[model samples]
Target chain A: MAFSLDTVIYMDNNATTRIAPEVLDAMMPYLSDYYGNPSSMHTFGGQVGEAVTQARQSVADLLGADPGEIVFTSCGTESDSTAIFSALRTYPEKNHVVTTRVEHPAVKNLCDNLETLTGRKYHISRLPVAEDGTLDIERYKECLTDETAIVSVMWANNETGVLFPVEEMAKIAKERGILFHTDAVQAVGKIPINLKDSTIDMLSLSGHKLHAPKGIGVLYVRKGTPFVPFLNGGHQEKGRRGGTENVASIIGLGKACELAAAMMDEENTRVRALRDKLEKGLLSSVPKAILNGHPEKRLPNTANISFEYVEGEAILLMMNQHNICASSGSACTSGSLEPSHVLRAMGVPFTAAHGSIRFSLSVYNTEEEVDFILEKMPPIIARLRELSPFWEED
Target chain B: MWEYTDKVQEHFTNPKNVGEIKNASGTGNVGSIACGDALRLTIQVDENDIITDAKFKTFGCASAIASSSMLTEMLKGMKLEDAKNLTNDDIAQALGGLPKEKMHCSVMGREALEAAIADYTGVMLPMAQGEVVCECFGVTDLEIIRAIKENSLASVEEITNFTKAGGGCGKCEGRLAALLVESTDKQSSPATAQKKKKRMTALEKIKKIEEVIEREIKPTLKKDDGDIQLIDVDGDFVTVSLRGTCAGCYSSQTTLKEYVEKKLREQVLDTLIVEEDK
Candidate 1:
């Protein structure tokens, strides 16, 4: 199966997406002709500030937030850091944080090193997930206490696409007077988000996860939320974030958000159907294959399947041979000796955890591409099973 | 992604001799699913003690599968005695070269081969008799020491890269560091004893100190954005200045005594004393 690069099928949108053509078109002028410092006093640069304001408004509209609440940052990690750090800074006497065990490294690592980073000993309650990768709200409620400063959880897991009850969790934390943050990097555009109806105080989103360029992100800080600036510089972002505006990527993100809003319906209907087709085809065709996350509470365009008795790196490399792109949670793929922390926290067995593959589709994926994957995957699994020591004939 | 060699990609894409041989003379299975990679190797030895046929089945990453395939290809028609002497380095060399982190794959191949040979001879393997140092991969002290000696490994990071000893929960890192020092001490003792018989002149001592500082000490410091310059060599006291991030660092004294001085003592003369220049 010799395929040209032009015909490559991409299904790793959770890792990153191809920049949308509309977004590129919107950003071209900003990159070449409209190159101006948004902080400059002159109108030439002041005009760029207007575009930034519009982008902020567009982002807020998508999230059902006020433009004043949106603080543009470098990326999702920066947003996550800023949100958590701001909460910690707001309540210095509080020494406890509530989070989930299956968080992305951006949030997980920050929570792990909070004591070292802040020079104060802090207790972290990392709430565990169930076998199907859903959080227990009862357990989440039990973790919050008077000493808890904030609760941080991801809206959707990047590896399994498992959706957490972040809204309910946020409401519970709000009743306790604790700040709540959600890393919505994977969930922002894939699912419906109305932050106005929700109790989440802060939310983090990355531009590249959608069809926008990288290096742009948004941290939604609710109005009147006690805040401290992570990066203190000039009065850019009203002194919230102190960096020169990433003029072009910010504009591109705005265009991408507008496009995502219009395509959300198709994302949940058409793209989700393709994901289901691919998932069902692989699980039914490949023996001993199992679904990794919650069957229905997951992202619409994501499927994580584990082909037992095989290694994920081998599966991914074989998939690469067919110009099919995906990601894996195997220890070998990550250069760590342990499998994905998310899968492990969900109690996924080693037999499946070592071979988990995540296919995160985007609106750009076609049914034909899904069919092509279905056609190519069974043989690939069979070939690898033939070479696997633990694989048994059914 | 790993920068796999063309040969590694070739073997992984189209692996040869992939299967289990029925009623084989000897069969060896190493690793497990929980550890993320495993290999089962079988060999058929003729009456002449030559491996007539060899095949393998592996559950692992591309490098592991490629290593097993390359090992089987290298094993076919080789004498049992020659196979006994084969090291993991030989398997890696045969496959062009594996990534430093993926070297454990070749190590797995060698272990499977050794187990197979032990089964053929009905002898218990000595490497298996040692205490398990890395519970994650079930690697033993004997295996760790052998990897260190064979590969000239210097750090815990390298041990993890080669044998996967401290790659897991890393509870065994302290044990691995002790084992490393034990192995390197044993390796250098004989040479140290031999060198102790001769007394070096002042010029020779200074030259040897300078060489060690440049070749051994500088690179290690530079990794941490630090540098060292040899200032003076008076008798056994070698004066050096720590530059860059090492300058004015609170842990510089510990680095000087534990790392720089220890390295100088091992590579140059055991009596050499290193002092930070005031």
Candidate 2:
């Protein structure tokens, strides 16, 4: 069946979210009539600069941070790179960095290529996760030492939606005098975060994952954190980053953050309930279906489920037939010939890893959409299982 | 999204002959759950060695399912001897061509068919006897060589796309490259011998060059609104002029050297030097 935009059910918010109507409304004027450069000497541009300042304030309010600490970059990847590189440059003597095995490739690939990128060999300790996709705090603490320049860990796993105790990990890094950064791209708006009360030196958040447009992200650096610019150019972003402000997206992100803050309760209650309903319904209806992450410690809006004996891409394509959008950690879907690193790090069995699907809900997802998935998903799994050679009916 | 063809989508949505054959003549199972795709093919053959029935169960992506469905459909009402000659390209063509990355699905279909044939005939497969090259996918050197020969694969990346070799961890890329060079050299030894003798007459050389240009090069260049014209041939050096959008273009020299020269070398003679007639 041909899919229409109106009927498309988007449950891949962890991948990216739909731009909220309010956010778009806030950004339209900036995109059209308010085309003045934010850094211009004229009043017309000064007004745009004021709007940028107000947007920065809104983003800061959402994160419980000061406006000065928010450094906007192109995307979450840039924010993550800026934070980690700033720490490494600040402590040139340190030759060790600590992160997790399940980090999004933004941090994972950066760490993996550090030696080749900088021509300096740095020891990296990737903390392993338990089978439930939860990290051992003690193991993370043991990996940290005086040689460690920065400890970068994700606040939540993108593939599994498994939450990590970044707050506690950051506090531990603080006691040891090591800079700590968290890639909170998946966690920021889905859950409550108050960086003002935390010891985290840096946190990264992307706009698109939280109802804003793509190409806008924020790196929250604490007031006293020493930093270096990743992109060295004209003085913008207070010399912490150097690029012309993506003005419209920044405004959109600010509006989105405000909306995310206001809808946090709805996200946790209604959206979470919908996610639970879809997850529970699929698990009950589909035989051999199992949840991929910790039941209680994951994101409220994300559900990772594995239907054994069926490949994830096949399941996703079948779901795509119904115009139900989601993502998969399967090797075939990722084009990597391996399942998700997060699931691999957690030691998910190959039988399940090859078939993992992630459905991440947003405020826009309706109960009716959840019901539609519950009805469509089971039969899809059954159909794929019937095609799967490994499947054996019990 | 893998950009599946309409045929692939059709077969995936409503696959034909998707079940285990009861009391089958032979059942072949290749791949594993760990590899992210597996296929179990069962065929029923008559006393006359005709495949009366064929069915498949595949655990993979849409391409794999589509390839399997297409394979089963192609197999029914075919002589077992003729079915043994069926290749992955035939399956891919039947499905209106799979995505390049998903070519291994068709290869898997072909392997399953071969295994099923071997099972029916009570003969051990020779391809399975080669030393394992890609540990991740359990692809062997013999299988890789066969795929390289059959598909005319030139690069490690193409080999990976076709056979899933060097697709994981990439530890065997060097080995894959060595095997590729070895296979191509073995296939081109006779051509190399001909080049060494400088055996081709000037008339023959011109004819071969024009044939290659007409059959191979012109269609490729025309895709980009470009054309090539053969100007002169002197011993081993062939001169050509680029016309249309390709004429005097910034990268026309690159096109002449990297593409035109390379294609002429591969098809006509390896020692043939191609120069742009500026």
Candidate 3:
């Protein structure tokens, strides 16, 4: 129950992250002296708008898109809805949507809600994941049709950290002339993404997931894409989205993106090495521990493992005791006497699904932290297993 | 985050009386490994059906271990019949109180007690006909009723522990509870000595469940380098937890319900239910 500055090794960065110092430094001006509205009538505010334009240009440079294509939103979820809703409403004649069953709730739940919200006219075709948590390209191809208005898929999975071939999927949708959108919330920092090279029409990113503050996100709508505003209000975001900017958060997000680009190599190398240490240590020491995502093509800093026969909450509690914060697919969900849909979608058994634990790291994690986790986890697993009726006689 | 009590945390950190008893007059085990908890209870009974000594070894989270320890304490010096009549809620009450999700741990303790008593009596338990539900925990019908009858247990979670039914693949919880309600009526309108043999003793319940596992559940799981262990039994409900490679196996729940519970139902109680402990 005590709080400390004791380097509490946080491996659940996917849940959210501490704001980077550079991001804070970039946002400080906006919160204090430069607080005028970017849409104000005077030059003081107009200069602030110029800074915003420069920030937007930085974002555009990273994604290889034009500054005009980037529209700011509250978070990844809002961006997702905007892309999805824009596509659906722009082409009302086509009422079918092709999406993966493994999409984040921002897309999945919204699609689920459409049945009731739209009087059941919008048909959603949910593609299933393979045992490896990858989508079936052929099955995906089969699901698309002339009646399909939108093809939405996540660039990477939040739980398993499995990357999808959104580029290929978006290309297919392009060939079929269907609008394509991707929730890149989990991949914007860890993986390389170029909007200029791919036929991807829309993409979404959350600022908090990439070490900026929360309450700011981005939606990259490719030039010439059909657009509809989800939020209806003041003429901000060039009428693409409504309301004044989350100026401080948006400034922080831009700075975070700059930091991400500079750290991309370190993220892919140093952070991944720490991640591998955590992963390999758990696997070698803990017998029968199963990794959840594809071994080769996973996020550099995310590891999801299932310890046999133990409940997830118990494991998390023990980890919390050591101030080693992570997450479990079962421990962090809303009321539903079920494991995470992501794990279940991959056909993970209930026995191990209850035991699924996730450790998502960030640039802040170090080798000492990884080693500390390595030292702490096996005993925790063994201790929990001792209480578990499911573990074997050994 | 749940506001766990200090008592709950204390019991969790320092659970008492864990490990299997070597030899004893009666042994009661409850819940399943697949459901993430189970208890093996051993008791020594005097000629007068008085419980002289009791010990327990439990494999479960903090709640299960604490509840089992608390149950062992409660059972000491009590008549076997009195101990058998103890309810899961009573066991929970003894430990101050557990979180709602952890109520099943206390229920497991109570189920284990009834099972130990049944073993001591040498009763030829009947509960040999029921349906399989909860493909995750390997639960059946007769098991649920036996838990209710032996421990005077209430609620869906209690039935789960004593029976290993709803803890996994929760698809069968409602059906298991329905069977439990149905069988209370059936058991009330009873029969004779020969019919009483079908009443389901703790040992008999274990024996029947083991038979089903041997005949059906193990064969399928073994194909996947997995296995299950019979930990405890209360009345008709027999508790068997998962172990080995099976512990982390993804299809483990499917094996429990589709294979384990299904087999038990084919041989066990028609109106009984099987479920898992929390």
Candidate 4:
């Protein structure tokens, strides 16, 4: 692990992160000698059940919710689907949903596929965003109506890191008696979220995004909200979600949540400073490099920069030579010929959209790594510009 | 992440002939800034009709640049006629292979080569004169058809991969799907020779009727000191109104029943009926 870390500079934390050491240490026993089924009527299984309860409490504490409100699932996608389908099934009469135009595919695709899933047509109001990738609350409020069943929005955009006013949106949605759900997969660990005071009906978060192992996720459903089971099997998760508990990953996620709560300050301060420095250095050194997303209202860890007249895949390949890792919003990288939906929805021009790069930092990132990226990026952009047909000498 | 080949990586990193050949015999430019990938290829031909030198300046992703570079390398010292016959698959094969999604990069190279050849010979390629299918990218039906024929593309998605025809807005997917069937049907066995004409769903009929009225009818009417508006469509019946000079014209009914219905039937559906809204 030490040797691997020395050679690689990973900045694509929003995509996925390396599991934290503490999370792994806490999960090792579950993966080894403590592999008892939590549901068995035996002392060994009883001990495992106790550990599972403790893990649920840890996750609940991180979100400032009651432990009973938490339902463990397979992944963020599953959690999102569960929360959304539950609301749809509970209010079968309602045929409308409100969501943002720029959503992670988890919520966006599910909303898009609602008609096919339920065998009934749905009217979906997709709220558009501004040029800065931020939504207008007025437009959102206008979309909510009496026929609306649920309002699903992302807390932070995966590509742009633009934060939405989900709390305020949820409040507005609640007044209309509509269930509000936020896919906070990218926001939970990076920012402070106190669901206890919020009007949000349901929240979904994935473990891998927050430095826990993959295949673990949490859906926080406020008590007394109308609910339906997405997965039906032997009573598990209070019959809210069914499947045997993913013991090791559940333990890891609990530890990861605890660590996230403890390190929230460092993530906001040091990581935010490093991200700003990286952004400033690249903007100053590289000509025609503009930042994507809202400048002030964004996640601290993410910096999406677009270097015009140069393709993102070429820039990423060039960066690969220096052992630097990042992600792109370019269509070429996504196996499609258009840039990310978020960038396109924000009206990012073709040149910039084709060349946008997303650098997502984490608590593990260091200032030295930031400096190394700042040093290596300018020449990469310059070299790509030299080959670009649109580049001018000025 | 795309699992690009070593040769693709090599050419992407150390691309060959990365400049313009000024005063060249022929130059072919394809794509645009709005299209996300553009190529400007210049070639110099000798008296023997041999390409003596070739160079390109590209604005696209890694595969696009590599395809341009590979096309130039393949064009150098080659006969003009042979270069004209060079396929996009050849360009991809020369660089081991490109990702399936990036095949359009190679197609762009082939297009630029054809455009350059046309520039030299002063002959417009048949595809260049064909009807534009995708207005977002200015991709023509002949171009999409040729790519579909050459690549044996089976779906709209594959056509997008090869020629970028339906990659934008996606208003042309139904058209592309029809074209895909048309091209593939020609290659099928006699047992499956019965051509299946696409039946438009109700939603599709409404969209197509509106599009025809807006795109084909309204503009022409407005040009003749007249205007037209589509009121609604219920099944085969189309309700419209002629405004401006047409509202009081003596031949307005004849224009509606004959010209308007004829154009709508030809462009959208054959069973359409025209009735002016009273």
Tens digits of per-residue lDDT, candidate 1, A189-294, equal: 9999999999999999999999999999999999999999999998888899997889999999999999999999999999999999999999998889999999
Docking quality level of the chain pair in candidate 3: incorrect
User: Which residue pairs come into collision in candidate 4?
Assistant: none
The global C-alpha lDDT for each of the candidates, from Candidate 1 onward, is 0.90, 0.90, 0.77, 0.88
Report the lDDT of model 4 for residue B104.
93
Q: Please give the DockQ score of every candidate, comma-separated.
A: 0.32, 0.30, 0.13, 0.32
lDDT of candidate 2 over A45-157, digit per residue (tens): 99999999999999999999999999999999999999999999999988778988899999999998897888986767777789999988877776666678999999988
- Please write out the lDDT profile of model 3 over residues A49-72, one tens digit for every residue: 887888898778778889999999
- lDDT per residue for candidate 1 within B1-278, as digits (tens), equals 78899999999999999998999999999999999999999999999999999999999999999999999999999999999999999999999999999999999999999999999999999889776767778887788888998999999999999998889877678778877887788664322322333334467768888898888889999999999999877545677889999976767767887898888898877866676653
Interface RMSD, in order shown: 10.4, 12.8, 8.9, 6.1
Best of the two (2, 3) by TM-score: 2
Q: Residue-wise lDDT of candidate 4 within B177-233, one digit each (tens)?
A: 877787777665222322344346557777988898888888888888899988877
TM-score against native, each model = 0.86, 0.86, 0.76, 0.87
True contacts kept of each: 0.85, 0.82, 0.23, 0.59
Model 4: DockQ score = 0.32
Candidates, ranked, lDDT:
1, 2, 4, 3
Output the lDDT of residue A354, model 4: 87
